[model samples]
Target chain A: MLTLAQAQTIMTTALAHAQSAGFKPLTIAILDARGAQKLFTAQDGTSLKRGEIAIGKAHGAVAMGIGSRALHKMALERPYFVEAATHAVGGSLVPVPGGVLIRDAAGTLLGAIGVSGDTSDNDEAAALAGITAAGLVGDTGA
Target chain B: MLTLAQAQTIMTTALAHAQSAGFKPLTIAILDARGAQKLFTAQDGTSLKRGEIAIGKAHGAVAMGIGSRALHKMALERPYFVEAATHAVGGSLVPVPGGVLIRDAAGTLLGAIGVSGDTSDNDEAAALAGITAAGLVGDTGA
Candidate 1:
């Protein structure tokens, strides 16, 4: 079962990765299975919008049970899915940087992590770090 | 002479402050004299809503020639101004957190910064950091 402690651990790890990478300040968010925020943190000098984006990305991942990057690929194959999903979510389901799926050792869905700032690759890396630090697995499939 | 470089610098600094303060992940944007984006960055994990909010705040600040916080206050006295400005900007002028005027050392208007995440106070502080880091001034009316 996913726990708040795990979420917090992921967020902390992501923040540290961002600082160490020498990227700009970052925003990290973790969402529970219900798509609610379990942990959210924005570094000093991070933009205000980072929080929203992080939440949106994580929400999308949790709601769909897939990593946002994979969703982006699916969007390309099924534009209708993308359109319908976006409309259904009231524009909160953004398939962009800073979204990752969290799973257990057995690949059971647990939650998700979203990160923003820097490049999309950098965001993915940070999210992965958070997941691993939390003793969870991250889905990076395309 | 105002330049995009200065605006970007301000935005970068503001984001850094936001992260250090433990605020939510955020999106930040800067607009030039013509109301064009000078710089835009969404920290790792920020949401799409933050982008909209940041842009709105920045637009409001530039259009009204006042900080967004002051605009929020003036909204009470001149609801019409707030309403009209909001409409004039195509519903992009949000009079809330993460927006401020950018002025030079001599108090000359250069541009504006908009931030979103956490609370309004935290947003404003981040924006102020950006302004000061850019060697510019911010009018928070505090």
Candidate 2:
């Protein structure tokens, strides 16, 4: 189970990384293994839809049981499959790099983190950094 | 515009109310007036869909520009209209009393709060108490 404190720690470290890296304002979402949101935050200047986008990334990762980087590749290789998958996930799937799965040292899935409001790579980097800070493995499907 | 600090304050106070009243575990959602989520939390042990339900309540109220208590009445009086309106809101409307609109003392709409996992009246009461603690007016359409 992902404790709320762990989720809060992940977000705090992620935002700190974003700040130090000089990324744009960000919106971040954390979801437990069941795909239920645990914590969410949108920076003051984030665009209106950024929060949904961030949640979509995290939700998609958890729903598909894969990191969103793989989903992005699938989207390119087979658009039709991604389209159907999107519907199956209730329209909350954003196939992109920023959605990463969190796993334990034993490869047990803990949850996911999604970040938005910067380049997809930068977003993913921030997420990975946060997961590392929490002493968890971040699987970006690389 | 609703500040994140205010949103945090609202959630903190609302949860305090729920705990004091011995309500069931809750999922709470807060949205800015533009219908974007600002903050969300699902207490431990909340059912799988409680978070979505909480978001639906707040999103529906903001979408319809009225508190969800009013939407519940509209649902009873004009079921078809309510049905259509639900579709218009992208299937996130929960026409129930737990969704309350937040407004300044001057009646300017700021945002909304939604709480789920207890009796609707109790949920609305907690939301109202939170808004009051934040020094904002909570319009439950009563």
TM-score of each model, in listed order: 0.54, 0.90
Candidate 2's docking class is medium
Can you write out model 2's per-residue Cα lDDT over A29-125, one digit (the tens) per residue?
9999999998888777889899989999999999999999999999999999999999988999999999999998899998999999999999999
DockQ of each: 0.04, 0.67
Name the top TM-score candidate: 2
Where is model 1 more than 4 Å wrong at Cα?
A77-80, B1-142
Worst 10 residues of 2 chain B by lDDT: B39-48
List model 2 lDDT by residue over B15-114, tens digit each. Answer: 9999999999988999998988888888888887889999989999999889999999999999999899999879999998999999989999999999
Give TM-scores of the second chain, every candidate.
0.90, 0.98
lDDT of 1 by residue, A3-34 (tens): 98888788778878888988777777888777
